[model samples]
Target: MKIIPQLLFVIAIVIFGYFFSKRVIRIRKNIQIGRKEDRSDQPAKRFRNMLLIAFGQKKMFKKPLPAVLHLFIYVGFLVINLEVLEFIIDGLLGTHRIFAPYLGGFYTFCLNFFEFLALAVVISCLVFLFRRNILKIPRFWQREMTSWPRLDANLILIIEILLMAAIFTMNATDQILQTRGAGYTATGRFFLSAQLIPLFEGASTAQLILGERVAWWAHIIGILGFAVYVTYSKHLHIFMAFPNTYYGNLNAPGQMWNMPEITNEVKIMLGAAGAEQNQVEAPARFGAKDVADLSRFNIMNAYACTECGRCTAECPANITGKKLSPRKIMMDVRDRVEEIGSSNSDEDGKSLLGDYITKEEIFACTSCNACVEACPVNIDPLSIILQLRRYTAMEESSSPADWNNMFSNIETNFAPWKFAASDRFNWSKE
Candidate 1:
């Protein structure tokens, strides 16, 4: 029945809305549980950053081959979704090609363009799958990649391919039905899908209609399912990248964000004028031990991570086979956040610093900022690493002996070297 299809479409819409909202609320709650810090400064610069880094994907061009392939997939996915809008309208009204009569030739042009992009998506996905599974790119096979991450990546690519195939099938069958005078709208020929016509030739009108309906439902349902799955996948970066880039650190790479209390303490110790008046109280804890102690941006950084391995690949510590993997750091944070979100209590006697990330990995970092520089979405894993290191040294007093000695010298003298400030120019005298 015509009404039956519309009824099914409405039920599917309601189901998608419910699950999508549930995941969004959980994510929002998890992100909000972290410490708050203002990142609203310089609206103009942030907007430009979002456009270039997130939308234009400027940072992905470091490696040209994968960059071009990724561009095809990314641009294709975004552009071809324009057809989904029409699909939605048609499903709701129980009509076929609702926009065909209204837009006429333009509708045909749009479908042709979508088909071209769909083909591009299929090609790009295949290349990526080959690179990941066959070529065995080292980054894709990292320690943190594990089973789920690898499978998630492969699944997303396969799904994209199948969804694109469904579109071609639907269009090809629709064109056949139109020619057969089965009350189908004549939207002219689609360039890419028209080539697929031969595949469905010699089939009866009933069979053709069945094929089109199946593809029609599959494509839309696949999209809805994808929207929900992304929240739980590393593909969350698809949406989070925009906001992450917009609020990315605008300060110089070398200029670390100091603790406010530490800054105030330093000024007071230096006896700067009015320093006592501006003195701030110390925080309950020195640095982050859990996700709750981290800032909202840090949690968001975890969520925004593409798990692309660029951060770990560029990390000097990881390159030298130290325990630190910047990608893992982000993944650990996200996992911990998810654990906290799902549990009854935020405290589980297991903290992020000790349980998820180890002291070895934290201490292995060279503080070189390579990971920060390499992240496409501007996620600063070094920031989280430093926070964990701070907790180890300040709260736990567990810094290595070599670092302790350096800290003692800095406290007494003016530098890491064990010499007086007044004799700092003695090297020049020698």
Candidate 2:
């Protein structure tokens, strides 16, 4: 029986590791389907951004109430997961509470701290659920948030609450067993779990041990399951945020980037540089028409979106009842990416521009950076919008007639108005 459990524990670890690694590999491959660009400059600056935004969660504090709730869950989960280190050790060695003897008093302190955080996380999850279901925050009711998106949000919160409950229950039963001198290691007092001792008071030692074992197993298994589920959930941001914030566009949010390839072409055409000659097989697409045409950073941005609807809430277009929702844009990109990434059908030639995102939505953007600024994470829906817009304007020549007229005026008369060059200065004289 001892050998069977030890073998089973190793097998569990291997299976979890194998699936998690495979999902990670798939995500990387899907992200790599996009065009590449270097984000290597200013390493020190990127490090600061990663530290401040990802670690400190600087942007989230802009909204105090929800931010506080979010911080409770976010910080609490991270701190509480430290217990997994000890759990892993115990599982491998077939020992119970492996760190209790080694760390002595400090181990007790750590357990107390973990229980406190676990309680906070449970409370935070409950409050968030109330906000989503009862309070019905307007942003949460956006068109894109219906069906699966809404359920996904609620499901994650419920999972957190359950996971925390498992920890508290496990600790409570362990405390009961400790009093009976039941061979369970005493990790000292846990403030929150101590209050639950009454619930198990009439239980036999054998029954308490069974309950303790069940809760311990449930907590660990739930954690492993959560790891796999998150890759497919919006909660992937929990892992992606560090890298996403590190590669964030450090320039002003409102600042736009000219396509370097197009700029270089223009410069060469105007005889501005010593141009070499031919190119082998670089991608010929000038702007994104499909997921593959987008830059790697933009694709990553889709995955990093929290789908909190903060971006849509801040969007001028959305506020004005226009077709665009910046939040929806990110959601759609992620949905389409997942669809495409998982599809095996060769006939499935769907693309983001026409199939998922419409011209109306893309054109409705006012080019404002409200979405960029409002995002708690550094996801740039504008970049994705602009890239698709570029495809419409340049590759398809599908700009509106008025926009085409403006382009013609700029080309022929060097201004938005169709005026002769000589007459352009005539208005100035007046």
Candidate 3:
């Protein structure tokens, strides 16, 4: 009994250490990549919007079934930690049912309920995997041309499978133990391990003990490994996602991206003529030139992406065969940031507009906010694209010929179309 506690403690510590070290390293690297100004310090509306989207998981509901399934999985994982604690106690202290007396009948009922919910989560995840792998869902296709290691995808699959296997196995083993006269003690009282007893009829005591030990170890190992993997993989969302969602920008879907203002004196000193010039030349300023230009929250967004490809799936640019996937754009930004920080190179030499993201890619965007509305993590790719547009239009005097003509017409005739100013109020029939 004493040995079990020590073993569990050591495993926990090792898992914690792995995650802590990885998190610290990633944070430091992210900081080195740089940060954009804090827009989160804005008004109360922003906070409210972030809360509704992030906490509410509002965007995820675009794919209602998958979203609902994930919601259950997420909540179940969090609530089941209490049962996990009991499992540890059972293993170490030799107490079969550790949580029975505390919450009584009600708690047991909930435990049984969530266990069924977890089974649903497993089924849903399998469906998702099959859709991605066998069905070749267009949404899951790689939008980036660059090569990625298959190992990354395989590792994620393996981890998820292990986690589900552990959950099901643990439940089945506990059911067997309960049926074999391991009365409803403090922990096992609320859980219906009794359902599993019928399956193990005629099994010897030795077989039952071995089964329990196997299930207990599987559960512990799977959970601990999952914790460690969360920090290192794209699954970092499992931990950082909630906080990222909690601190997200909460505003109307299509709100324009704002550029910070520069005082007149600074503008004059830099020989800048207007808001556009001021934005380009301002020190510690405008468009993202390096990783450091991204806000910490944006960096966290990169880590939080589930690679569900919902953003790309909804992007008009991607559908039209343009070299832009809103999904890949986020990924590219992260990659460029890392490149800039590690190499100490200037990304400003590369054009923010054009072939890098492509002119068609920009124009293809209807600014409809479909991608933004679809993203589960609240990544506003439209805002990033607009920032690039602003830099090109203001600093370089570069824009699509059609858009430039429209701007010229708007300035000269006071109308976006080629119409006479006197005709503006023609609706007032005399």
**Which has the greatest TM-score?**
1
lDDT of 2 by residue, 341-415 (tens): 788331477889898899999989988899999888799999999989899998999988888999999989998
Clashing residue pairs, candidate 1? Answer: none
lDDT of 3 by residue, 273-295 (tens): 76354444355546543345556
Residue-pair clash count for candidate 3: 19
Which portions of model 2 show Cα errors greater than 4 Å?
A: 264-283, 344-347
Candidate number achieving the greatest lDDT relative to the actual structure: 1
Report the candidate with higher TM-score, 1 versus 2: 1
Tens-digit lDDT string for candidate 1 (1-430): 6699999999998999799999999999999989889999999999999999999999999988999999999988888888888889999999888999999999999889989888999999999999999999998999999999999999999999999999999999999999999999999989889898999998999999999999999999999999999999999999999999998999998887878788777777887666667567788799889989999999999999989999899988898888899999999999999999989467689889889999999999988999998998999999999998889998999999999999999989969988888998888986
Kindly give the stretch of ten consecutive residues in candidate 3 with the minimal lDDT sum. Answer: 183-192
